[model samples]
Target chain A: MALPHAIMTALLEDDMSGYELAKAFDVSVGLFWRSSHQQIYQELHKLADRGWLQCATVAQAGKPDKILYTLTEEGRDAMAEWVLGESRVQEGKDDLYVKLYNLSEDNANHLTAEISRRREHMMQRLYLYEKIRRRHYANPVSLPVRRKGVFLALLAGIRQGEQFLAWCDEALAMLGTIDEPVE
Target chain B: MALPHAIMTALLEDDMSGYELAKAFDVSVGLFWRSSHQQIYQELHKLADRGWLQCATVAQAGKPDKILYTLTEEGRDAMAEWVLGESRVQEGKDDLYVKLYNLSEDNANHLTAEISRRREHMMQRLYLYEKIRRRHYANPVSLPVRRKGVFLALLAGIRQGEQFLAWCDEALAMLGTIDEPVE
Candidate 1:
């Protein structure tokens, strides 16, 4: 349900073909809300049917025609309403944490590898977020008013990644000290 | 589903009736993996069917018999296998951050209230986590080897909540200075 709203927000930025939207999603909206290409395509049809989006076919000189989607007035209004409405706090369902909670000496070696893998993953995300911050928000005070909120959301992601990395370090240190049982 | 796995973890800690499990979930397992009472009951039945759990009925004075669930050998094996396997990193889907990304002067006032509400909620959780830490992990170094992993997971939750609260503070500070358009 919220996918349509996320799509509307992306379309508000620029009208694009489904291919462009999927690529853009991987970088931006998808950072917060993940959806598969198939799901995105399906939602596009539903949104077009509901009149929230209008699609236009553009024929290329050497390629097949592509459909570009843009938001309608209703879609814009709906987005505005959603912004002003109450937000739901999403429940956390981190499988890594669950694994940690159930970890035993028998599986300590396996978990140590997983912790390292997760730390590397968090490091990559942190690097990406920092890159975004440097590129878009080097001078936060000079940013346009419209971009300030976007910057805030990015900051949240950056902070989350940093905190998680710190926790991973602590976990690795603790795991290193615990003696693995001798076979 | 992960629900069954989470259920198994809770049951591993202590065998309890369906009602007791539900209440325990709200306080403990629910922190990491959320599920409704109905969903818990449904999964319980499925787990029993899968031979991962066994139920025993015990009659109580002035009350109907209650069925208590305990993990079987197969369930233990499943949990151990799951722990050793790769953990899927859950995608973050925070509605507040989405709204923040799309916020405009028109909806700024509404988002301000939401940020405050979320900060208060985070504060409550922080307090509860602190209480648990004091009661159970005041001396973490002295904790049993088996409990070290659980302590680490709780530490993760505490750190995440703290970081989220800090982000909420930053958001409120930024929103306060933005000039709202005069209606």
Candidate 2:
């Protein structure tokens, strides 16, 4: 699906071996898309077979040679077509919301604990987003055209994390007031 | 995987025929978890075979008999267990972000139109969520224990939609200022 296109974009920025691509995915592309290294490697092979990507083998001293992947002319054209195509709204499936919808009074404590744990994770992500914003987009008003889209995406992530943290506080406060029946 | 759980949650609330369940899914459960009617029907059959659900054939006036699905005791227990278990964070895969990340200067007009289209959809969702909040959760503080969880989930949806709309506005504003080169 989009994974192939995502890989193409990453390669367009710079060619890298499979190992480097996996590491880059973990830090950057993985934020919006989650993929295992095994999946990435499989897709790389498929892209090469489809003539969308070219591979160059680099010999290393006393080690196995690494294959670097780069987007071919066909790959770049495909990405351009995709960028101009219509996109459907992404519907995200969240199990936590399903659990919340079905939660009974008996599971109040568990739900509260889950909310707290999720809040901690959101806070950590928020901190990281803020750090990136300050470092890369300190002056949003004068951002280069190429970087504006990226800055906007980061903004969306930061706001989403903040909204989640706020919801966690609201849920915790409401749950605190409900008196649990002593078993 | 979560579809089975989502179906169980819906059936727990009320017994419904397959057609009815499909319609209800579009308006309610579909907000957090989306499933096609074919997939829902397939899962319904699997759930019945697994003894997690029981189906009864009911006669209707001037129509063929319909099978209605209800949750069994085993199904309820399974749902309870799932509710209390730890849930991993849901990673949302947005293709729009991928497109934005790779967009070249030549595609600025297309990206702008796509952003506008997405914003309109988000606005409509925000309106619907607000209407639901006003009608169902008018006084959330005085809600029954069972309804409180649903209310919180609704609040989360409303806030998320609002955050998305806000981000869309910011993106639009930034995109408007960039002048595309004439071909």
Top DockQ: which candidate number? Answer: 1
Q: Write the per-residue lDDT of candidate 2 for residues B1-183, one digit (tens) a residue.
A: 589998988887799988899888765767889888899999999999999999999999998889999999999998899898989888768988877777557887898899889988888887888888888899998988867887888888888988888888888888888888877
DockQ of each: 0.75, 0.73
RMSD of each: 1.3, 1.5
Report how far off residue B106 is in candidate 1 (Å): 0.7
* Model 1 agreement with the true structure over A73-165: per-residue lDDT tens digits: 988888898888777878898777777778778877888898888889879988988898998899877776658888898899999999998
Q: For candidate 2, what is the DockQ-based docking class?
A: medium
Q: Which stretches of candidate 2 lie over 4 Å from their true place?
A: A61-64
Off by over 4 Å in 1: none
Estimate, for each residue in B1-183, the C-alpha lDDT of model 1 and write its tens digit. 478888888898799888888898876767899888898888999999999999999989998899999999999999999888777778888777777778778878888999999899989988988998998988878777557888888899999999999999998998887878897
Model 1: what is its DockQ? Answer: 0.75
Grade the docking of candidate 1.
Answer: medium
